[model samples]
Target: MTEPARDTIHCARFLPHPPAAVWRALTDPELHARWWAAGDVKPLVGHRFTLDMGSFGSQPCEVTAVEDERLLAYRFAERTLDTTLTWRLEPEGTGTRLFLTHSGFDLDSPMGRQAYEGMGRGWPHVLERLDAALGEAA
Candidate 1:
């Protein structure tokens, strides 16, 4: 018997900002566009939106869970990628410890494998951009 694929990307970053600032960057469409894709993201569950992923085109997403400045989760890329992206925030000293989980990649398929590999390499840079964006605003 073969073991199930453990295909998930986990990233954590310590932002020198409060949880509220990090939360805003994750949910506010304008702020989000600066660090990542432009989307009508909100901290309310069931909100549906699309992120303009440049060459990757527009990717649909639906908010699945939220907890103020604590946590946010959404279905990402819908039919194509079919993954969930989750963010969690924790207060650490005078900063916020942010965690990200990108899950549900069907590694057996070519598209899934490619996305898994590509995104795995890409998320760190994205987080760095997030940090820089926050820094600029401060």
Candidate 2:
């Protein structure tokens, strides 16, 4: 029997900042570029943009949902993986708890499996970068 394909990557982190600060890091294109890729990311529904993923080229994206500093969801790499990336932020004492979910990977395909594995390792580093960026800003 073939092994089941993994279809989602979830990561969470607690940052020593308010939700608004964390949200800005997630939405601001310049701040985003510091952590992950460069993109015209905004917390506005129906916005469309592309992220420069270095050697992976540019990935087309569209904002599917937005809830101010609470949540942001977008369709990432629409022409490629067609996955959905969601970010959720919740107030926790003096800081915010940030959660990321990247879903809809078609693990049956070789590309999907490869991406899942690569991103599984890459996402943590990306989050660490985000933390470092926030530290610099703070």
Candidate 3:
């Protein structure tokens, strides 16, 4: 018998900012904290960091892959949730198209299911906050 496929959260947002600007928002700790969680995220592979996820406490993360301002993939939540978050930035017209893939949800577990559902609903708002943060920077 085979197990079921895991759930993955996919989100895309077109920000009216250059890829470099969006990339800074994703990589720079202060800019990232303004939009998302506070973390020492860097565009360097194999770097380890912790994101302060507010009420959910801090989550450990590790940079698994990075490609300059183009792509970044990281292991999120480490041993507990054990998920991967990949961010892809593509230049689009006058702005940037940002794609987010949050995968490795073990839906069989209650914690995983809840997190999958919660984050699925929460990502849009998070992206909106990112846009607002970019606007402030602009």
Task: Give lDDT tens digits, candidate 1, residues 1-138.
Answer: 975348899999999999999999999899999999998998889999999999999999999999999999999999999999999999999999999999999999999999999999999999999999999888
| Candidate 2 per-residue C-alpha lDDT over 1-138 given as tens digits, one digit per residue, 9 for 90 to 100 | 965336989999999989988999999999999999999998888999999999999999999999999999999999789999999999999999999999999899898889989998989889889989999998
Off by over 4 Å in 2: 1-5
Task: Please provide, for model 3 over 1-138, each residue's C-alpha lDDT reduced to its tens digit, 9 standing for 90 to 100.
Answer: 965345899899999999999999999999999999999999999999999999999999999999988999999999999999999999999999999999999999999999999999999999999999999999
Top-down lDDT ranking: 3, 1, 2
Q: List the residue pairs that clash in candidate 2.
A: none
User: Candidate 3: where are CA atoms >4 Å away?
Assistant: 1-6
Model 3's C-alpha root-mean-square deviation from the true structure amounts to 2.9
Candidates in order have lDDT scores of 0.95, 0.92, 0.95
lDDT of 3: 0.95
**Backbone clash tally for model 3?**
0
Q: Is candidate 2 or 3 superior in TM-score?
A: 3
- Pairs with steric clashes in candidate 3: none
